[model samples]
Target: MDLPGVVGTFFAANTIKRECQLLLLLREYVTSLTMACLVEDQCHSTLCDALVQLCIEMRSLDSPPALIRTDPASGFTALCNNDLLKQHRLSVRNFLRESEHGSSKKRIDLSLADKVQLLKHLQLPGVSQASAAKKFGVSTSQVSRLVKAKQQIFDQFDTGNHNRKRQRAGKEEEVGSALFLWFQQKISQGARLSGPLLKQKATELAAAEGSEFTPSDGWLSRWKSRHNIAYKKEQGEKQNADFPAAQHWRQHIIPAILQAYNKDDIFNADETGLYYRGLPDKGHCLKGDELVGGKKAMERITTLVCANMSGTEKRPLFIIGKSRQPRCFPRDPSRLPVDYGHSKNAWMTGEWFAKWLKKWDGELRCKRRRICLLVDNCSAHPSNVALTNIELKFLPPNTTSLIQPLDMGVIKTGRVTTEAD
Candidate 1:
């Protein structure tokens, strides 16, 4: 018998007997032992001594010698398991083929460059099809096909679609390019694209092109990743603003006032609703049923929050609540950091805005600064209000996100900090 057949039969017998100790020892010194078996006498006796010594070592280990799991009917399958291979001093992990690709028929996805290299090896003299397949870790039949139709493969490679199996399956590059272009245009125009929205757009485009294929969710996700498109949390939606008007206000009007007043004099005021008892409905000290039935949990307070762009000044909060004197309020509301007001629905009206504006005007008169109060063009804000040393500038309609400095983050930070307290 040949040396290869003899070695193969010996390992097959050991695997059937589940001789884990012999398997471990073989893994450690298989290369050197194979050389010795071919060149020296009495190598089998030497191997038997090594296996006996390995059994003693196995007893000391916390776990039994690792064996590959298999169906009982299939008999022992693997020559040596991963655990024994890992413990070997030589670390021959790379020498062993991966278990996933052990089958010859499995299609190996390779780049055009790699295919070219494999084909070039096949072109060399004395390289048989089987040897070339082993070298490239593919089936012998695949190697034969590549050698037979080398010219066709070269043409496919040159076209840059040789490795793109999905294109052959149904997806066209032209459709993908069109979808990517639409995505880019939408993003550039400040439109937010959610997962569902992206999938919808892809389906619409496929229908319009009269193609039966609609991109699956997985395909759309992969497309985004392939194009390096990332999803981010949108702080606010960008509405179309009157660019000419906004440009004039920022470039012409705002700059013109710098000579007359300092940065501290410029203030932005905005209103926000606070759900004061907005704790998690669950996981609190109270029972879930108690929280579900509680009135305090539903209570909300509307507050006008103000901050100067220079960050040098912050106005006292003006809170609008449904009650004139809530149970939580002190006898003297004037001592609180926040100014209190009462409303039927806890909403700020134009009348309250006018009064609040006047109150700030009196405070500003004492500060002796020429005030430029920037406000949003909301219905609550009074358009015509008489004030001393106070110039009210209403931001263009729907342009609060673009112009209001407090909307940038001041009010949001204040809310979060307050909630923490």
Candidate 2:
């Protein structure tokens, strides 16, 4: 009875069998679990409680046992468009018929289903005399007589509305544009009309405009709301890499390079968007109502955060940036653009840090030796120049947050970059 395909047979016997089997398995599993709890000496407290409840049943001297209905759930029986009771009915029927050959053979034992099912298997759907006969489990002659009577009655009642699809109707090119403009006008005017009123309004308009009319009701009202376009974008999330950089930092890099420096001279540095999750990369988003509102309102407009941490002291510097997309060098020395604007900010790159190291340790004799700079293992972080002055143990392959102070809490996480990036 899987019968051709699942949806093929409107009420396929196979579908019923599957539904019954699922419920059977669920009931069996629950029973077995309850039994296990009873038989085992070390059963969990909750399982024992469930086992006790499972034994509640009514038995009589000469009748079938009745279920001791404990508490009937009281509330709305209909959940929106969902019918929980109908679903429960399938399960309930399966539960009662456990003695049947197997749960897999359950089906709707109804006249309509039987007739339709036979007709489908026989490759006949037009409901003919002979087809109906075999389909309905009746004599062929009997079906022929019933069909003939119905056909005669139908012939007498020929309605013009029957089989409209057979009409070879064509459409004009401007049909769409005209309909949209007309509907928009009606909606803007807040007009509401039905049946005769709708037809009368259309006729007057047609006469004035010297064109025919097409009036349809309930069509506009049922359309999707532009205001409720969709629920929050069910978009996919982006990932920075195969394994999080934070993982690499935690497992491979920290123990080898940064832990020793942590006892004396080590500090973490990073920057973040002024906006709260303006970039939803790798950070916790504002929950509840904050997210319920528009995403644009949370966008950081003109600010960047430069943060540094040493010992327990945390420094937060809010910097703003200009809208120009130019690459600048620390040694560019070209009198930083006067009109770069007050919002514009800058950071010294790896190459600049290297030269600064040479000046401090070689030329200027600054006594900052054996210094460890805790930074992410981004390609930008470990420059040849920076390595010459300060030792940067590249964060282990994929670790970033597990042990890295930056990903842990010191600095805010960045937006999850796409794999293509």
Candidate 3:
């Protein structure tokens, strides 16, 4: 037989299946060796030793060798000539060296949600730890640890929708629990709260509890996240709003006014500032690139809108600008689309508001109609404006953004439309 050719075929095997097949062929050949071939000649004996060492190393690539040959002559005869067997042994050694260098283990981080899902998967009847680990891309030991803590994991999941990667609890547990209870009570009372107020309250609670807890910004943020709290922009007043008064007005005062006046005769008037020439405040740019914007335009106007309930009547817009006779106006002021007024700074003044209210009241009286005009309590709107047909009622101070009809969205919609134009 061509011994060098047989050895060459075994060395050419690349994949595991091919390598195993060749190994089996080599074993069979070793078993078929005649006593004549096993003769202890120096050259043949040297070749036999090399083949035995190569087979041991190859088998050790995956698992420990079941049995190692102390006497090479007992297992195999001389299979290949000197040069061929030497080259094959060198190739096997180099392959084993590379395999050792390339092996590495990496760690995987699993979130709480993922861990819960994995626990659920482990409850299947036919699944084993090894198979579950493979399915979840984790190790068998990790799966075992999760199984040990399955009860704790399930209990944590029931607390909230906390999908954090790691489970952690606040150091000051009593303070946090007490603070959350206080937060819930305040929210139930319809009180407006801000972050600074929450942090200050937390510090006070901690001090009362005899704990040295400092409510830093980071701690406050984490506490909020754990309790699922969010921050919203307070429209008119930050924390000074009188919720009890507003609630009382809504429950008692408002119903009396509604009963006394017709829905069509209840009017709301509000003034909003308009930056007619202002550009958008936000723009998109490539990441890591500095964004440049044009200087903001200060050209502004004050517009007053009046509308009655039942959507039956809408007065013409009253626009106040800095210039009484703006160059943009037509030669005739009456040709303008809106009622034009003027102030030194384009702001509504008490005199102008009183004049406007008197004009509206005179028109209502001529038509033999009485109306209730609801306006916010601002310095410009005098409660003493004298009118026979117009009953001026001011909203409780600092509650306009919360309860005023025009502020609910009317002014915002008008501003958006003006900007679009």
Model 2 lDDT, full chain set: 0.35
Give the CA lDDT, 0 to 100, for residue 226 in model 1.
48
- Local accuracy of candidate 2 as per-residue lDDT tens digits, 142-237: 444434455432432242212121222223213323443565577556454344543455455555667675644432221212111111432211
State in Å the error of residue 49, model 3: 78
TM-score of every candidate relative to the true structure? 0.51, 0.27, 0.49
What is each predicted model's overall lDDT from 0 to 1?
Answer: 0.61, 0.35, 0.67
Worst 10 residues of 2 by lDDT: 71-80
Superposed by TM-score, candidate 3 places the C-alpha of residue 145 at a distance from the truth, in angstroms, of 28
Model 1 shows how many backbone clashes? 0
Error of 1 at 337 (Å): 1.5
The candidate maximizing TM-score is: 1
Q: What shift in Å separates residue 137 of candidate 1 from its native position after superposition?
A: 32
